[model samples]
Target: MQDITLASAAEIAAAVSSGTVSARTAVSAALDKIARLDPRVNSFTDVVAGRALARAEALDAARGRGEPLGPLAGVPFAAKNLFDVAGLPTRAGARINRERPPSERDATLIARLEAAGAVLVGALNMGEYAYDFTGENVHDGDSHNPHALGHMTGGSSGGSGAALAAGLVPLTLGSDTNGSIRVPSAFCGCFGLKPTYGRLTRAGSFPFVGSLDHLGPMARCVADLALAYDAMQGPDPEDPAASPRPAEPALPGLETGIGGLRIAVAGGYFARGGDADAFAAVAKVARALGADGTVEIPEAARARAAAYLITSAEGATLHLDRLRTRASDFDPAVRDRLIAGAMVPATWVERAQRFRRWYRDAVLRLFESVDVILAPSTPCRAPLAGQKTFVLDGVELPVRANIGVFTQPISFIGLPVAAVPVRIDDGLPLGVQVIAAPWREATALRVARALERDGVAAAPAAILS
Candidate 1:
């Protein structure tokens, strides 16, 4: 069991199914690791060890009876605190949410993963109200990067990335609005999938921006990423944004090479702002995939601006009541931003919404010419924890907001993106976004798998020392 924490979800499931390893053994190892290592990384906000062991025992009993189990059977996984895990009050990285009653049932995705036989380990830490790019939270302690313990983990899925990076779990769930999932994935050197908007069910999860919100999986391997993503695909009557289209599995086509697909590097807005390491990561992946040509997405910068406006407005509107009643209860930074957003002119928001449609159309037109677009996932690797500023293009910028510069524009258009880690020699890992057309997650995962196979990119286990 020494190497069990580092094993993939598929391997764990296979072992448990064949009785080579019991479900209780796997879950116990995960819980034990969390107890031993989590204090250093601070990835978990709550640990459901008791619940996980109970579920593992139940799964072992089922297998003993010769009953069939799901694909992810006996695998231990966790979700960002925003996901409503039954018996835990969904904190969503806020001090105020701690007062709310415990969730009665698991979030839709959590329930689905459980149905697939994965055990719930716990809920993770995050930026308050899902409004941060740097994973530092004033309420709960900051979620430290597992690769470099003194560095940032990226947010609001900070703990999700850190947990996976620490080899605490092979599967984790995180939400990406502007770049929550992708940013953390990039900074933590893990694989993360941000499916097209409305592709995954958002019901039972805390909302940051109703229009921009997306829930997806993060894992150490592309295959594991596809495994979790494939199981969670379906229409949910509870989520108004959940697509009515039938489920499309991504695992089958993941191994298919990108021979016929036209892939290119993203230029124009995406090509700028980041440092050399960011560009190098993208170029490495592009070279490995034989994608030499570059495609320019029109008005990507403006789209990012529009996304910010929409996110702030929608988020402020969602929490308007709470802001008014409990002003001091929120993180000062998050509270102030929401208050300011609440005060933005309605005409500005309306115009932003109008521009959003135009931007989406322009991006779709590019997809007509290319199957995938490669871009940097983050401008640089993880910054030292508690350090606020980073020099970008010779100018110092705030670390909190600028980390998502490369990621914001793509997510602004609601396109699917798979963040694949590129390991730098003697340096921290960075990531490249393999972006695909709407509802074409299979294509993005295919590209990522190729990079993984070629050894051009990977999520090497983080060294806690």
Candidate 2:
């Protein structure tokens, strides 16, 4: 049972589908592990034991009836708290959202995963309203890195990262506006995919940066990330931003390998502004893939700056009422930032949007030459929990604001990125971004699969007491 808890989503599904393991057993193992290990990790904000058990029993009954199960059969997964999990309030990691009524339905991604036979065990913790890069949440106690309890779990999908690293669940759903998803994956040592913006539906989740918000899966392996991404593909009428593109199943083409594909290392901005480990991780992955070419993304630094302005402006607009009525209810840091955002001049936001379009066009042109681009996922490894500052390039900077320095520009324009963990030494693991052109998730996943096959990138579960 304990072993089942640590198995990948693909492995558990195969076992359950073959009757070698019952769905109930798989879910129970996950529940028990969460109960035992989650206290220290603080990954879960809620544990839906009864709902999970009941769903598992139903899956078992379906198997008994000779009914075919979906690809993710019997897998236990969780979502960041911003995603609605029927009967629970969509916390969005904000103190004030706790007063809202319970959600009446699951988010689109959650429902899709359930349809694919993935059971949702609970809602995980996150940074307030998805604005944070560090995973610390003042409302809920900080989510500790499973590998080193005192270290930070990258946010705003911090809990999602911690849970996978701690083996609390094989998969989790998280939203990425800037670096919410990839940052955590890098810091916590896991595989995370931020699908092309609008590739997946955002219908039932709480809004952060509406234009920039993206929701995707995080897992310990590239296979699981592809599985979840394949299952959740499709357009949602309820979400106006949902892409109209048909489901491009990444799992089918995941192992096609990166043969005959032009892969390059991202130079210039991506190459600088981090500790040695960050670049080392990218270099290790580049070597594994035989990637000798490098491409300098034009104006990447400017893009990151523009992303911040847009995020602050949009986030402020979304929470203006809350900022007006419940300012004291927020994490003071988050509140103050949002307040500052409200004051951003309209001319600045307009200029940022105009630059965003130009930047997107310039970056997309690079994809014509290279099928995939590799870059560091985070500026550095996880910092100590509650630690306020870190020195990057010999200059001290606020940990929260700069943590997403590498991730923001990529996400600023909706590109698909697969963050694969690389552990080069005994120290904390780092990640390399396998970035592809819009709607080219398979290209990124294929590259990630190659790295995994070479054993250069892997997410080994943390051994927690």
Candidate 3:
């Protein structure tokens, strides 16, 4: 049998469906890889070995009985620890949450993926409470970048990115409130989708900034990202914030290309800041897609500031009870931020919400003339783990607060974005965001597929000794 670890989710599924490879074989390969390599990568916090094997066997038996297989068939995937996996505590990358009893049910997205024939192998590590931009977790340890183990993987979707880059799993589920998904994708060199806020059901997952939170998939290929995304779409009454809109599959239109799409590079706030590699990556994708037009998003700097204020206030509100009692059990950095948020004047939060409404309206108007917008996913590539500050536009800034400078303004209003990795020379990978209007995920994904096909974007597996 071929090494299933190296195969894409689509290839693995097709092989399993065709009886060329059993579901058990595919799941076992992933489990074996995780066992052998996770010590160095620290991607998985909890491996559901018995559960995965049982699920795989059931799938193989069904196939043998001539039952129709789902699109994902036997592809192995993992979710951020925030996502509830049956029989395990939803850690949310916090030590306090580990004391909670195991969940009785899987998160809606997890159930949706399993229904589509994807096997869940484990829960991956993340930054504490999804409040971090750097992958460092004082509780679970940092999820190291696969390309350079000494560097960060980005967070709070850090493990999701690391797992894909290391080829431990073809797909991962992560949440992006403030670029958690896209930042990791940029640092670890993988494709990630941050569907519009509330696009995917958030039920059964631990909350972090409920108003801004979004859950989506990450993968080594654009097709796998779309496949996982398609499987998880639709309404869930359990999540009050979930969209009532019907599922619109992106896979079918993924290869339609970007012929009619009005693609433009983001200017003003996006054009400046960060290392040259960040701009170069965006320029590469823009050039590949024949995007010469530049559009400015007005007041983008204020938009980011508003996003931070909203995130802090909402996140603190959600964890008020815990913050009141188990303060010492928390990561000091995350705990301190939440504590500070508790003191944010309600008037300030109200002002931020008002600005958010205005910003969303202004940005959506830009989409009227352009089908898609391209920007850098992160300020730069992976920084060394524990590194404090970096110079952006010649100004030294804290790494954690500024890593998502380009991404915050877009997600601030819940825009659907597809983060595509652009590998430059032999250095770590940089990512470019393909942004689309609200509820237009397919449009953004289509552009990402175009870049992937044009050899301008890719997520090559990192070589590990």
TM per candidate: 0.99, 0.99, 0.99
Worst 10 residues of 1 by lDDT: 456-465
Tens digits of per-residue lDDT for model 3, 118-211: 9999999999999999999998889989899999999989999999988899999999998999999999999999999889999999999888
Which stretches of model 2 miss by more than 4 angstroms? none
| Regions more than 4 Å wrong, model 1 | none
Error of 3 at 12 (Å): 0.5
Error of 1 at 322 (Å): 1.6
Question: Local error of candidate 1 at 121, Å?
Answer: 0.8
What's each prediction's clash count? 0, 0, 0
- The per-model lDDT (C-alpha) reads 0.91, 0.93, 0.93
**Residue 374 in candidate 3, Cα distance off native in Å:** 0.7
* Total backbone clashes of candidate 3, pairs 3 or more residues apart or in separate chains: 0
Query: What would the per-residue lDDT of candidate 1 be over residues 44-115, giving only the tens digit for each residue?
Result: 999998899999999999999999889998999999999998999999999999999999999999999999
Instruction: List the lowest-lDDT window of 10 residues for candidate 3.
Output: 456-465
Better of 1 and 3 by lDDT: 3
lDDT of candidate 2 over 319-348, digit per residue (tens): 999999988999999999999999999999
lDDT of 2: 0.93
